[model samples]
Target chain A: MPRVVVDVVLKPEISDPQGQAVLGALGRLGHRGVTGVRQGKHFVLDVEGTPDEAELREIAENLLANPVIEDVELHLSGD
Target chain B: MRIGVVTFPGSLDDVDAARAVRLAGGEVVPLWHADAELPAVDAVVLPGGFSYGDYLRAGAIAARQPLMRAVVDRAHAGMPVLGICNGFQVLCEAGLLPGALTRNSHLHFRNRDQALRVERADTAWTSSYAQGQTITVPVKNGEGRYVAADADLDRIEGEGRVVVRYAGGNPNGSSRDIAGVTSADGRVVGLMPHPEHAVEELTGPSVDGLGFFTSVLQGALSA
Candidate 1:
């Protein structure tokens, strides 16, 4: 089995509404001094067979990363 | 025809998606997120819902599901794939489509019947509709904002991959009012609206969403 790690990040300068909402709520709850908040996700997978880098890149381009406001970094392990 | 609906943990709309597939004159197959097989289905639907509870990010955790590998493979093989709402987010997360869905510009969870223009009706999922036709579909999500680089947006527009655009007003501040898009081959489509919820006239919206399912079916039969 091969492992694939996916790192997803929102682009800089783009407003994060969800993160801002959380920040606002936190401020209301008496937690202050939090200047910025941005949220993203990461995934590590174990798959059945070896996947070529090109195939993985295609996966990242087509299904794993939205080329619009997010960038995806895919690291293949144990290939 | 058999349509497969992939269910990730915390998926809220897979059942409805399956029902929509059945109503659209197709057999429904349930595919688990952990499974690698795509079943013997002619099409696939990545339905709406907060998969993995939107913990890491909306649709981000679910995008890495084991079954998604097969889904990506089959989708690239020209199998028609539709992603609605959260499914759309998953599509973006999985890199099946361009643009990332962010929080609503107003910083709220928007749920409403939105009017959208069918920008490109030639795709497998939208061929039944006329280009520039307006349709209403329900959109509900906290992270439905769509954003992309200007160049990428221009390229998508240039390539005619943009399938739908918000009509009256930008609901979630999507770039260029883009509500839906198709792959280069027009086989895979992802949209930020719940078309399945608006399929029936009794559901309060126009029965325009049914065209998506019908179009895919017709396209499959024709091919």
Candidate 2:
């Protein structure tokens, strides 16, 4: 089996309000070790037999994530 | 002249866009997002709404719609196109416009009458307004902050591509207080404000928004 994983995260230059809010909550809970947090999306795809990394990359860039404000990382594995 | 207004599943302002066209003395032609062929019209308007329920990202799915392909084709040929709110996001996602609209900086759904300064009035969609004119219109959205590369923003500012800039205060953390912008050719425009909602004074704060529709209508009819 072939599988591909995609991770989408906001660009570092852009502000992440959700992550900030989470950080504030964590502070209230006394989590002192964590300095910062960022929220992102993760996707896993099972391509059955052989998977084309180029095609999966295209889909992730075009539909799964917006490159203007996000960065995508693709990981492939075989089992 | 006839103007086409596109409607996606979650489109909330197609009726208001159509009404503005009528008020501007232009016949309205309804265009469905799923439809491949656009009706015979002088121009197209992508009204504001949560198209595809803003899935994955705002305007991401709707930008790939069949109707958008047709609109893009016409826009490239110099046909005027106006996109408001979510429609603006679609334009960016479709590559008809630059930059992207993301969540508001404060992460709140904002609805208010906002003041905007018309930066340029030479485009097909803003020929009726004078340069440096100020107008008030409704601005409402959950994710409307605009973002782009610094070089791109600088280039746009240098080329006079910015159409409108927010006045009084930065409403949504848009880069350089930009509220609207036009394509390099001045045919395609996208803005995150609801000008259609302000076309009628009784329904909105002011009727200043009518100029956008009238400008395009007159331009098309005269051409």
Candidate 3:
């Protein structure tokens, strides 16, 4: 079986308060080396055959992420 | 005039929106999200709610429903459509409007009587409001922050498509303090504030929200 991994993230210019809060917590926990954090969503889809990047891209653009404020990356692998 | 109020599975404000339409002297047509055929109605209102439990992004699932396709078709044909709160999110997702509503910058669920300045009073949903008039309405949401590319923001501002601007203070750090906007034809309006919840003075901060409901009737007559 093949799997498609989709990662959806907010655009670079968008403000991510959730990410900032995580970074704040990291700083408070003494992980001073980490300067920033951006939270996102990840989905792993198991398909019966080859994972089509184009089809996955369409799904990501239309459903997984909002293009106005978010970006998506797809990683494909098989077992 | 007959106004259709869509009741998605999680819709919580459809009743209030229907009541507001009836109060404004329009016949109420209750529409279900699964219904592909939109009944003959002069206008439509997408009331606010956690449709699809806000799954995979708020309003994203509901935007692709069958009824929304019918709505998209009618809206493009010049039918007046108003999307409130979560409905605003759906409108943006459905490409009927520009920009997207992101999480609040402060990361808090804000509920309050919000003051808004009417920026464009010529839209179908805002004709009753004088340009630059201030009105108070109830706004309650966690993901109501309006965001767009800097160029898009400037373009919308330059074109006078901005229908309302937040007054007094920014509630959710929306870019340019924009509270609402209208489509190019000014027939489609989407706002984060819940005007249906403020149509009655006894139950709301003011009856200022009634104008949004009434303005559509006037728009229909003149169109």
Candidate 4:
């Protein structure tokens, strides 16, 4: 009953045109104080066993995110 | 001279890929995603489409399928492989090639005849063309922007693994304007363009795409 959550985002150096478009839309809508925004992917995994950091990293590295253009962040709980 | 063409769940180009193979004077062997065996084929072609419904990223799911396992193994053993469009995504996801295809910079699903230069004609999939030759092929996809780490880009560029690049103009904002690449040994190649769709002048911009199929067939025969 262990749970793992992952967030994958484009590397900082890479341009995210979609994210920029969203930011522009937000500005157009008169949303105040939201200076910047970036878009990414999120995944929640319900694994059979307690997945250690390495296992979680392996999942993110191999499947959840592409290492070439995205960086992955992991959160584990419900141990 | 048998070539295997893998058809994933959402593949749209398998038939065209098979036809291209046949036109190139090679036998076509249809491969399924669930099959673990690759059968007896000199080379393999992973056709394109929204495999796995483009969920969890295009090509990520299809790359881990059983058929790709055998294909990847065979590719590593120096067998020739060509991945087109979504298949190119699968190849990169499987680590048979480098980089990844993200959503287009323009945020549009582009479909057009694209001009490309054969940067490395020595590759197995490009043997029919000369280096720096320009050819037209149809490119269609939403997630087709190729990206790689700076070091990786430099490495591939230095090794002459960038097999083809956008010639007339950059279509998808791919890094270094790269449209296709090959492995270190030039046995495995992946590209965003659908050469299968461009093999015939009747339905395509030109018959130039036929060369890729012919190149693979000749490479397999000579190997």
Among the numbered candidates, top TM-score falls to 3
Candidate 2's DockQ: 0.68
Which residue pairs collide, candidate 3?
none
Model 2 chain B: worst 10 consecutive residues (lDDT sum): B214-223
Question: What does candidate 4's lDDT look like per residue over B114-204, in tens digits?
Answer: 9999999898899999998999999898889988878888998998889889988888889999999998899999999988888776898
Q: Give the runs in model 1 whose Cα sits over 4 Å from its true position.
A: A1-9, A18-79
Summarize candidate 1's per-residue lDDT along A1-79 as a digit string, tens digits.
7888877777775667767788888899888988777776677777777768888778675555555676778888732
Docking class for candidate 1: acceptable
lDDT of 2 by residue, B64-144 (tens): 999898998988998899999999999999999988998888888989999999998999889999999999999999989
Clashing pairs in 2: none
Tens-digit per-residue lDDT, B14-114, candidate 1: 98788778788888889999986778888899999988888756788788788888888888898889999889888888888987787788977888999
Give the per-residue lDDT digits (tens) of candidate 3, residues B3-93. 9999998998999999999888899999999999998999999999999999999899999999999999999999999999999999999
Candidate topping lDDT: 3
* Separate DockQ for every predicted complex: 0.37, 0.68, 0.82, 0.73
Error of model 1, residue A15, in angstroms: 3.1
**Stretches of candidate 3 above 4 Å error?**
none
lDDT of each: 0.84, 0.91, 0.93, 0.90
> Comparing chain B with the reference, what is the TM-score for each candidate?
0.97, 0.98, 0.98, 0.98
Which portions of model 2 miss their true places by more than 4 Å? none
Candidate 2 yields a Cα-based lDDT of 0.91
TM-score of chain A for each candidate?
0.68, 0.92, 0.92, 0.88
